[model samples]
Target: MGDGATTTEAGPESAGVGAGLTRAHWWILLAAALGWMFDAMDQRLFILARSPAIRDLAAGADPSALPALAGWATALFIAGWATGGLVFGLIGDRYGRVRTMALTILMYSVFTGLSGLARSWPEFAAYRFLCGMGIGGEYAAGVALVAEAMPARFRPIALGMVQAASSIGAMLGSALSLLVGPQSRVGGWEGWRILFFFGVIPSVLLVLLRFRVPEPDRWLRARDEARRDPKPGRELGDVRAIFADPVLRRRSLIGMTLGMVGQIGLWSIGLYTPELVRDVVFREHRRELAVEADSLDDLARAWATETGGDADSKLSEWKAEADRHVGRGTLLQDVGSLLGAPFCTWIAIRFGRRKAFATAYAMSMASVWLVFGGMSRGVDALWMLPLLGFCTCGIFGVIVVYLPELYPTRLRTTGMGFCYNMARYLTAAAPVLLGRLAAGAGGYSRAAIIMSFIYVLGLAVVPFAHETRGEPLPD
Candidate 1:
């Protein structure tokens, strides 16, 4: 690869001395981190809510058919992600990062809230696709802003931290799932709907971003320079520019492939933890549910005749038990993710970007195999969930740190967004493909095991990766 096409190796101290990271830099990181955090939370909320929403929508349909419908919904969401990433990435480069960030946040938040109003599966899927577009745009904008703003020494660490913040969003989503549970009713409405209604929380960040954050100096300078001496295929935010040259095209292909590997693993495998929890761990609660059902029937007469206190108490008790037994598996996985995300930063700092990515990919493959192949008990999942999260989710830290390094400032957002979000097109098929595999193979676990080989492609890409550790962003 041409040197300018990718990050060149730099010594630890080569980040070199300048004015150092400023107050503006810190503010930018915070803004980017918050945007990414809320974006991730929105995604996690969908993951937790998808099955329940579909189950409710298809109440009268065959139970076995729910997975297929859910898969279709996921595909639609992924398609939206791909579309938003491509379109907004160009906008980010040509317009500005902060403005695009605000627009995307609004788009996603409004759509997510609207998803709660979806009375049918098709309606829900449409809302989710729109939400996915907003979610998809935020990543490239936030990461590009932070990458360009921070000092070189702090760039990787800041990018990792920004990526790490996404785990907090996922954790919050898990907490929301736990708080509401699928069966809980509020104002006679299902908890899943309420959870989506709350998806508007991220929209609140728009004020902070618009009022507090400023566009990066690098982007401003590059924008001015591009206008002054524009060249063919070198226009700001032009998607065609990314593929106009051999070096950029090669880097773009590798970067997108790397992103696809992680996206496939996450959307296809990691997001299914809730399903496993429901099917495997929650199965043990069947007897408890049966007992509660019998008790509820007896209490119904008492509720009609008496003051109804006893029936209310019994219902509350059952709801608590059900909430405790359900979603625990997915929540535990979130805790694991919290730990894993930061670990990626430490790994990238200690080793290099390539090593960190390779390690994460290898561990993800193995951990996934162990989780799907042998995990039959809830207790086993407690320990294994963290390992699975650490590997699968940690690799993203490397991606945010590494991808922008592959492009110059004028094309940074466009290239990074295309590489990351365009992969969604391939990954968008993950749910459908896995659904078929699960049905044909007779189980989710078996299909997951077969899917685990996708990580090997990540490992193959490692040798060709452009090492960005301690290096400045390409100028």
Candidate 2:
């Protein structure tokens, strides 16, 4: 295991603890959370943009093959995420957290704009992969910075708020798509491309970060402490030290298991909500929807204007209505995510981490299966998607809070990145796995049902987890 927290790092001398996170610290939280929020917005942009982007890029591909192609893109994006997290985690621990956050945000923001310009599936996926790298790295840096900077008593709450703020980014993407996302490639303007272009806006964050946020004092002291008492085997950011030490190894494995449970359940089932709505829930209503064209929304009509002046066509109207249904469904699911993340944090605060996790896992299983197996139309999705989202994605709060508490100051970012990003390595294949399952077992709903059982694995793993509720983040 790693050694104790350096006195200079975790010692009461750490400022801002006096005022329950004083004004300066609130700025710290704001900067870190906004960085994470923009990152979440980029991620949501990709999820919402994936199918449409694939459709536009693969101009002549068979309609039946599009989903499979999109799965490949998701897989590559996730693989890049895992790789970037592992590398940048080490960089943060050894060099500094602030530097890592800056580099990652810039990397993703630039690549996100590039994603809007890709002409083929491989090109688009490559841009997304690079963007994923920046995003994956940001999580470890942001969470560790927040965990180390806040006083022990309020750290969990602060971290929970950061996670909750991500839901706002997601909601932004959902709402933006409904208002502005185009349904078809009209006069060379693709709806998905327009969205990716907007993602570049987050690049402006570096300006705020430049003058405001600082590296956590905890990270600084640990680096200095190691310099003064250089231990040969326990160097800062030592990836080998993480596993070579027994207690840290145990913690690493358990953390990876917990991460995998959520990542797979989310990437495999929960993240696919839009496709599920488009392919299953909204599939049977084409004729019914056609009859209601007179009842069509002005927002939907405005949304169709991206058709390069062909807004009055029956085809454009139908596409606009279809996309709107998917948008509302997505927005509801994200709303649940906004609330659910904080609910899990609150549970951990009151009952303890283990109980909160167990409850979330059990509910995730029930809600995902119920929604997947029973829901058949947009009406069913209104209530069901929110519940599914609440149960499935909320444990992200527990993860952001719990993992940082499991390691010492020296190994904190490296360990959190590994345990969290490592699961992503395994989860990288989930999109492909779901595609194959969907192909063989009828469709996405059935495939999602098979995947939902992974949450049951969370139930089994919960007993082995160490509860760190109310504890100071391990030094």
Candidate 3:
């Protein structure tokens, strides 16, 4: 512990009042939740829109090269995420968390909308990368702010709620795709473009946040103490402070390792739900078409001749069905995520921190395997997608609740940001690996199953994580 080493143990007086969160706590939680929610929406929007954007941009290029281009674009976004997280994390420590958070929200919101104006693949990628940087910075600042501000007893719920709200943001993206996507064409703009434009909505929240939300008292106190110190490296929010001592360094590494497991499992495997849905639905459409065409050849020929149309009408119908299938799958996944986020809080509170993580890891592995391995039909996917979403994304709840508790106010954001974002360097390559593995005989399922093993690594590391339940935020 550094400057603010308040004992985590509950005193008799404090223990008696296990009532409810205060107004300030609710406000902090709401602000953090809204920011994180929009961040998630933008991320899912990019994932859903990437293919269409790439296809249009690569219009004259070889079709086979489009997948490679998508991979590169995804990698670029991850690069931006990693870079922004590291850089803004330091800024958060040096500056006030609320100020840094507002700036990050503005940064991501503007760039995300600008991504809509991209004319070519490179331009689109450039804008997305910039947007990713903004997205990356928001989490550290928001989580750190909420962790330090909320009442210690309510901290877990507040943090978990913030992470849970992201599922709604993701759902908003999916809903937009269904409503304004290329198929629907709201306002005559492409669905992807319209979705990107919606990114501007979050900037509105930024105004309210900056005007109303207060900086954590802990951060203010730490800054004041650092200002009074005359020694070298007495500066507030020093990123290096996390590694200056053995205990801090060990905690930092453990947090980072845990984050790495979640990132690889998520970015590589879970995020690919759209692609898998598309493939399964399209393949099913083709098979059904073949069977129908074979069974009703004479009747279909007569009907076609009478209607003055060819077999293309059936193809159009199949396309529509495939789209519907994918839309439904996405909706279910979001629903699962909604439920899972809250469930994480319950589990962590009922059990301890380590056990909660262990259970989540186990569930993640099992759900992912079942979704990708045994399922084939769109209907089957509709049921399985939510379970996958629940397990994969729900675990992030632990991050906001656990990481900040491990460090003191001085190094809190720095250590938390470092741990959360450092894994991006390795996980950035996940999309490329997924493409390669999908190209194999086993396809996306095999690749996803292989990737799910990343969760097992998380389970292995759970024992080493320091238990933080009922503990106060380290000064």
lDDT, each prediction: 0.79, 0.81, 0.77
TM-score of each: 0.89, 0.90, 0.90
Q: Write the residue-wise lDDT of candidate 3 on 1-475 in tens digits.
A: 2322122224322243334455555667788889999999999888877876787777787654655677778888987888788888888878878788888899999999998888888899898888888888888888888878766666677788888889999988888777765333456666678778989999998777866777777887888888888466566667777778788898888889888888888888888887677667655554654534222224345446656778556544544565566667777788898888678767777677788778778888998888988768877868898899898876786776788888888777778778888888777888887777776635678888987888878988999999877766677
TM-score of model 2 relative to the true fold? Answer: 0.90
Model 1 C-alpha lDDT per residue in residues 293-393, reported as the tens digit of each score: 22233543444355446665655564455455445656677777777767876787778878988988988998899888876655566677667887788
Pairs with backbone N, CA or C atoms under 3 Å apart (clashes), candidate 1: none
Estimate the overall C-alpha local distance difference test score of candidate 3: 0.77
344-381, model 2: which lDDT tens digit per residue? 98888778889988988888898888989987876667
Residue 4's lDDT within candidate 2 is: 16
Consecutive 10-residue window with the lowest summed lDDT within model 2: 1-10
Q: Candidate 2: what lDDT?
A: 0.81
Best by the lDDT measure: 2
